[model samples]
Target: MRIEIVEGDITVRPVDAIVNAANSSLLGGGGVDGAIHRAAGPELLEACRELRATKLPDGLAVGAAVATPGFLLPAKWVIHTVGPNRHAGQTNPALLASCFTESLRIADGLGARSVAFPAVSAGVYGWDARKVAQLGIEAVRAYAGRPLEGEKPMVELVEFVLFSEETAGIFRQALEESGGGPG
Candidate 1:
């Protein structure tokens, strides 16, 4: 698998799927969730509504993920995962790591070759940027290292797409430290 860090908008990344750091409601809130919802258009919201009305009536659990079609965005699918809120007294690192792990698992199930992820829980959620980057890159690297039925990983490329240069740099450094930096 190829892991890279790019400083840009996650909405426009031409990947098969992009991970949204969504709230548990999946109804679209501030930060990356709102941006993805707006870019994916009303259909995305409808999809989330459908999920809530059916499979996820009680809303998505933190660290778990669900996928919706990317209606008006460059990507084909959007993988929504709720990150653990640090300020809410949810400071478990495993929860943060699960965000990346679960998203990749969902993307793999969707037969996605590439995925873009934001700095989940880094902003507003009150998680430290460096810790988020470290945990995220570590989780993705561990996931990529695991072999599937074909002895190869399903997700070929994982891009840490951050809107802020500082966050992007942090992820870049983390990727390098993990020995999974851009090829």
Candidate 2:
């Protein structure tokens, strides 16, 4: 697998799937979630509404993930995962790691070759950026190292689309420190 750290908008990425750091509602909120919803246009909301009306009536759980078609965005699919809210006293790093893990699992199921991701829980959720970077990188690395049930990994590329250079640097450092070699 190839891992990349990029400072840009994930909505514009030409990957097969893009992961949204969404709230449980999955309808759309502030930060990356709102950007993805707007970029994907109204159809994205319609799809999400259908998801809520049927499959996810109670809303998505934190760390769990669901996929929707990326209507207007450059990506083909959008993988939505709710990050644990630090303000809500949810301090488990496992929850944050699960965000990355579950998203990749869903993307793999979709047969996505490339996926872009934002720094989950590092924005309005109030998680520390460095820690989030560390956990996210670790989770992706571990997942990539282990092929699924004797099948080759479907997702080949994982790109971290950071909103700022500082965040990108943090992720880069974490990746390098984790022996991922600046990817």
Q: What C-alpha lDDT values do all the predictions have? A: 0.91, 0.93
With candidate 2 superimposed using the best TM-score fit, by how many Å does residue 64's alpha carbon deviate from the native? Answer: 0.3
RMSD of each: 1.4, 1.0
- Provide the global lDDT of candidate 1 against the true structure: 0.91
98, model 1: CA deviation in Å?
0.6
Candidate 1: list runs displaced more than 4 Å. 147-151
lDDT of 1 by residue, 81-152 (tens): 999998999999999999999999899999999999999998899999999999998898888777455456
Q: For candidate 2, write residues 46-91 as lDDT tens digits.
A: 9999999999999999999999999999899999999999999989
Question: Can you give the TM-score per candidate against the true fold?
Answer: 0.96, 0.97
